[model samples]
Target: MNSTTIITDTHTHLYSEEFAEDRNEMIQRAINAGVSRFFIPAIDSATTQAMYNLEQDFPENIFLMIGLHPTHVKENFEEELNHVTKELARRKFYGIGEIGIDLYWDKTTLDIQKAAFKTQIQLAKHYKLPIVIHCRDAFDEVFEVLESEKSTDLFGIFHCFSGTYEQALQAISYNMKLGIGGVVTFKNGKIDQFLKQIDLCHIVLETDSPYLAPVPFRGKRNESSYIVNVVAKLAEIYGLSEMEISAATTQNSKDVFGI
Candidate 1:
C-alpha cells in the first residue's frame, strides 16, 4: 500500500489494555501503512472514557462509536443503556454499536441482549446515526431484530461478518455492509470463497484487532497494520488489485459511517 491510499478499520478496539505499552508505536505503524481511519467500538461504560481519551489524542484519525457490547449486557443493562444515551446526547458519535446478540457466550441473557439491541437501534434512529452491529453465533436473532426495525433510518456495518453467502445477502438487505477482516484471509475462513459474489459497494474492511490477525500473523496479536493482509486477500478474492481493494473498502467505510 502507498502512503496516499486510505484504509479504514471500521471495527477495532484500540483502547484495550492490550496496547498499553506500545499504543503510540502501534498506531504509527498503521498510519505509515495507510490504515488511517479507525472506527473504535465501545464495549461498555468502563471503556467510554478511554475511548474519549484515545480520540482526543488522535482527533483527526480516530472515530468513536458508543454502545454496550452484547456480551456486556448483563444485569445492569438498563443503566448501561442510559449511559449510552447520555454519551450520545453529549456529542456526535459515528454510530451506535458493536451492539447485538452473542449467544456463544451466554444464552441465558438472550432476552436482555435482545432488549438492549432494540433500544440502541431506536437510539440510532433517534440520533440519525448509523449503527455498527456485532453478531456472533446469533445470526438468526440479529436478523430478526433488524427485520422488525428495518427502515431507511437503519444502516451500518455488520462488523466481522463471516456467515454463509445467503446470510451476507440477508445482511445487505437490511441496509448493512459486510465488514470483512482477517477471517477472509484465513485458510479455513470461508468468506473469501464467495465474497467476490458480493459487490464491493457493500463490503468494508476491518482488523478487529489485537485479535483475528490474518495468516502469517494468525494466532498472534493482530494490529491495524495487519489490515493490509486482509486487503491483499480481498484483492485476490475480488479479482482486483490490492490498491483497488483498499480504495473500495475505504470508500465503503465512509459510506457506512457517513464519514
Candidate 2:
C-alpha cells in the first residue's frame, strides 16, 4: 500500500472481543495498510469501557461514538438509554451511533428498537454529532423513523448500507452517506451491482470487522487491513485506482464525521 494513501474506516468495532487476543497487532496491520483512521461505534453500556480502552491505546487514530445499539434494546432499554444519555452529558465523542432497527435478530423488540433509534437520533442532534446507523432487515421500519426525524441537522452515515439503488437515493436524500464494506465484494452482494451509479461523495469505507469479511478472506475473521481489498474492489467497480478510491472515501468519511 502507498504510504500517502489514506483510508478511513467509518465504522469498525475495534473493541470487539474477536480481536482481544491480538488487538494491537490487528490495528497495527490496518495502519500499515494505509487504513490509518478508525471510527469506533458503541454497542451498549457493556462495551463502553472497552471502547474507551481502545481510544486510550490509540488516541490519535481512534474516534469514538456513543449510543445504544438497536439489537441490544431489551426490556431494560430505558436504563441503557439513560446510560447513553449520561455518557453524552459527560464527555466528547465524534458521533452517536450504530443505532437503528435490526429485525434480523429479534422482531418482538421492534417497538422498543424504533423508540431507541428515534431517541438516539434526537440525542445525536442535541449533541451536534453525526450518527452511524446499523440497519438490518428493517429498512421500512428504519426509514420510517428516519423520515420522522429528517432535518438539515440530521446527517450521518448509514453504516454497512445494504439496500437497493432507490433505497440508496432515499438514504442520501436524508443526508446520509452510504457505508460501503466487505459486502460489496461478495459475488451476490447486490450493492456492488449499482454502487458505481452512486457518486463517490456519497460513500465511505468500512470493515465491520470480525464480521462481513470480504471475499478471498470471506468466512474468515475480518480486520481493518482487509479494507485494502475493499478499496481494490471499489477501484475495480468505479474503474479507478486503489489510491483514488481510498482518497475519495476517506474524504467522504471526514465530511460525515468532521475529522
Candidate 3:
C-alpha cells in the first residue's frame, strides 16, 4: 500500500561479487530513484550468506529467495538441494527461485537439471511460495517440466523472459508472470515489439543487475539504479508514462510475491 513511485526489480543478484565494492551506495541510488523493492535470487550455496547479508543490510527494501540456479547444478546436486531444503525450513524466503533448465551452457547436465528443477518446483508448492525461473535455449525443456507439474498452486516469474507471444501465453496459462529485464530495451530485443499485445498485469520489471544493463548503460555492468532505463523502455512499449508502468508492474510483483 506504499504510495511512492514504486519500482520493483523482481530479479537481481545483489549478492554478486561485482557489487562488493559499492553495493550499499548502488542500492541507495536505486532507492532515491524510487526503485524501492529488490528481490534477490540464490545462485548456489556459496551465495546464501551474501544473500542473507543483503537482507540484513536492507531488510525493509530487499527480499530474498532460495534455490540452486541452473548453471550451478552439478553432479552432486542432491547435496545442493539438501542445502536448499534445510535453508527453506530454517528461514522465511520470499520465493524459491532463479531455478529452471538452461541448455545454453552445458547440455550434459540436462537430466540432473530437470530433476533439480522439478524438485524445487515441488518445494515451492510445499512452502506456498512463488518461484523465479531462469530459462535459456531450453524453453521446451522448461515448459515440459512445468507442464507436468502445473497446478493451481504453481505460480511464479519467468525470469528474463525472451520468448515469443505464443510462449508468453503458455507461460501465463501456467500461472507464470514474465520477468522483463534490460534485454527488453536492447535494439534487437524482439520481445519489446510484441510485448504491447500481452497484458501488463502478466509482466514484472527486473534489472538482473551486474549484468544485462539497459541502453545508455548497455554492455556495462548493471546496477539496480539502472532500472530507470527499463521503466522508460516499458513506458515507450506500452505507450504509457513511466509512473504508470512503474505503478502497474510494481503491483503485479506484489501480487506474485505477496509483499
Candidate 4:
C-alpha cells in the first residue's frame, strides 16, 4: 500500500448480500488502503438491480459489467440472456462479464454454459466492452470458446484465473489479462510457482469478495480491503514492492476495463 499508488479491485461482488451489514465501512477500508476502484460483475438478472444501485451509490468508484454468469445458466436460460441483452441496449456498462464456463457445480450443464458464454462474448464485442471471464473446472471448454471468438475485439480479464503457466500464456494469446485474486496467496495455490514468468502487464487484482479472501484472511469472508493481501503476494511473486504491484495492476485494470 503506497500512498501514491492507486489500487483497483478489478472484480468484486460488493453488491452481494454478504456485505449487507457494513458495506460502506468495508469499502471505505479498501479506499483507505489505496484500492479506489471497484469493478462490479453481474451474476444474472437477479443481481442487476443491486448492481445498478451500487453504481448509483458510488458512481465515481463503482463500475458495472453486464452478463449472465455461467453457473446461473440453466433451464429458462434464454430468458436470462434476454435480460442481459435488453439491459445492455438500455444503458452503458463497463464490460460484459462474469461470464464463462463453470462445470464445477453441475457438469451436466456444460453445453448450455458454452452457448451462453459465446453469446455473451458476442455481446461484449458488439458493445465494444471488455469481458471478465469466470472459468472454473472448465479451462479446456472456456479456452475453446475463446479460441473460436479470438479476434482483435475479444479482450478482457480472465476473472479469478487459476490455471497452469501454459494456460496463462494461452489466455494472453487471446488478448486476455489475468484477474489475480486470493488464490495466488494460498500455500497450495500452485499458480504461484510460475506466475512470475508471466509479465506484470498481463495481470490485474481482484478480491471476488465474499468468496476468495487472501492468506491470513483465507477461509474468512473476503472484502475489497483484503485486495492488499493479494497485491502483497504478487509483489513477492514478481519480486517487486507492493506499490509497484498495485500501480502496475491498477494500470492494467484501466487497460482492460477502459476506465
* CA lDDT scores, all candidates in order: 0.92, 0.93, 0.93, 0.91
lDDT of 3 by residue, 77-159 (tens): 99999999999999899999999999998999999999999999999999999999999999999999999999999999999
Residue 94 CA error for candidate 2 (Å)? Answer: 0.7
Residue 91, candidate 4: how far off, in angstroms? 0.9
TM-score of each: 0.99, 0.99, 0.98, 0.98
Could you give candidate 1's per-residue lDDT for residues 1-259 as a string of tens digits? 6768998889889998999999989999999999899999999999998999999999999999999999999999999999999999999899998899999989999999999999999999999888889998999999999999999999998999989999999999999999989898888899888888999999999999898999889999989999989988888878898899989888888887788
Location of the lowest summed lDDT over 10 successive residues in candidate 3: 1-10
Arranged by lDDT with the best first, the candidates are 3, 2, 1, 4
Q: Give candidate 3's root-mean-square deviation (CA, Å).
A: 1.6
Candidate 1 error regions (>4 Å): none
Tens digit of per-residue lDDT, candidate 2, span 1-259: 5699899998898899999899999999999888889999999999999999999999989999999999899999999999999999999999998899999989999999999999999999998899898999989998999999999999999999889999999999999999999999998899999999999999999999989999999999999999999999999999999988998999898888889
Candidate 4: tens digits of C-alpha lDDT, residues 1-259: 5578799998999999999999989988888988889999999999988988888888889999989999999998899999999999998899998999988899999989999999999999999999999999989999899989999999999998889999999999999999999999998998999998999999999999989899998899999999988988888888899998988898898888778
Which candidate's lDDT is highest? 3
Global CA lDDT computed for model 1: 0.92
lDDT of 3 at 99: 98
